[model samples]
Target: MRHAIGLKIGPVAFRVGSDWAGPIAALADLYRDYPPPTGVPDYTVRLEAARPWRRWIRPSVTVRGDHMLPDALPLDLAHGVLAAEIGMNLQLALGERRWLLLHASSVERDGRALIMSGESGSGKSTLAAVLATRGWRLMGDEFALIDLATGAARAFPRATSLKNGAIDEMLRHVPDARFGAALTGTPKGRLRHLRPDAQAIARMDAPAIPALILFPQFGRPEAAEAMGPAETFVRLTQASTNYVPLGRAGYDALTRLVTAVPTVAVDYPDTDTAVGMVEQLWAALP
Candidate 1:
């Protein structure tokens, strides 16, 4: 690897090295505010050419790291930044055991956290980005870290990956300097990474009490339904990346979360309605 960059996002630290300078430069710019790892990084991601000769040819990047999928495919050099980001996420998904990792986006207000999880088009990431711009503190966009013992939501404020229309939507509220270059023709379609607000980066270490859990569904007629503990438990277990790996500890942590937090399933037609729905739900929380 010729170029390398180290970044710390909340509790997780990552060292990413690349055979080409492009990926490293992109990461350095995107993660400019994040500090390097204090000691050793929690994970290391290496981006190398698929073959030695391929380095200067029509280059493609192979994502190799501490943890990887057996048959993971290589990505074009143009998408090297995405490959590095995915590599870091893969390491945590397959290796982390320190906290109960939820495939959710989270934000905080008044020391309380609101967690939102859903499928690919859930709009949770966009909602989180908007909320952070509004008044809530963006804790995380990809994975919401929940303490096993304390049940608090720890901040993991990485750059928000906004896709398609979501990108245009965020550009309206967030400043131009806060966004990364647009990348097109990726697995997730055209996307851009939005740097979290200054406040989110500054307060990335703060932890908030788990106050609400939401399963948000976009493009639906507006509706909000209460979710029972059993349903919430089942949904979260499926959403977690390492629930089974943590064994009984994971079970207990999730149980505590489901029981203590008010869970709801909400459907909205657009971002504004979705935001209103979240606000209403939060206001109604006891």
Candidate 2:
């Protein structure tokens, strides 16, 4: 570990070490506003060169961490920031157990959380990002932390990864927003990272009760429908990364969430329309 940086995103902390200095430097600049990680980190992520010579001859960053995929591929050095972000996310997805990690984005208003879960290209991230710009506090854009005991939604506000058309859309919405270099030709295709707003970074310790859950789908006609608890529970089980690993705790927490929170499946054609729809749905909440 030649170069390293420690970061604390809400309840979790990570000490990331890299063989090259580039990734660490990039991480420092991007996460400049985050609170410094304290004590021993919750997990460790190593960004290492695939081979000794490869560090200089076309560097490749291999994400080796606390928990890993046996056959995961290494990323090119040019995508060091992406590699580092991936490394951190990989650790949480494979290692976290204290809190239920949902593959979703979240925002908050009046101490109530709005959680959106969907598959990739479902525009959850973009919707959360746009919502954040309009008075909503961005809780997270990748993973939402669901507390096991309280079922509260904790903040995990990392830099939001904007891909494809989303990059241009955000650029238009926030012309002066902090954005990382656009890394093209990556696995996810034409990606960029948008730093979270200052309020979100500064108040990362706050947690909110889950008031609403949305299964949002993009590239569709506008519509909204209530989801039964049974269907919501099943969909969330699929969305969760550590549901089975947590056993009874996960099961109980998830059941409570699905039954208590008003879950809805929403469809929309664009961010603007989705924003209006979201406001309507949230306002309808008790």
Model 2 clash tally, residue pairs: 0
**Which residue runs of candidate 2 sit more than 4 Å off their true CA positions?**
none
Error in Å for residue 26 of model 2: 1.0
Model 1 accuracy (lDDT, Cα): 0.91
TM-score of 2: 0.98
Across 1-286, the per-residue lDDT of candidate 1 in tens digits comes to 5899889999899989999999999989998887667888888899988899879998989999999998888888888889988998898899999999999999999999999999878999999999997799999899998888888889888889999999999989888899998999988899899998888988899999999999999899999999999999999999999999999999999999998898999999999998888898999888
lDDT of each: 0.91, 0.92
Per-candidate clashes, comma-separated: 0, 0
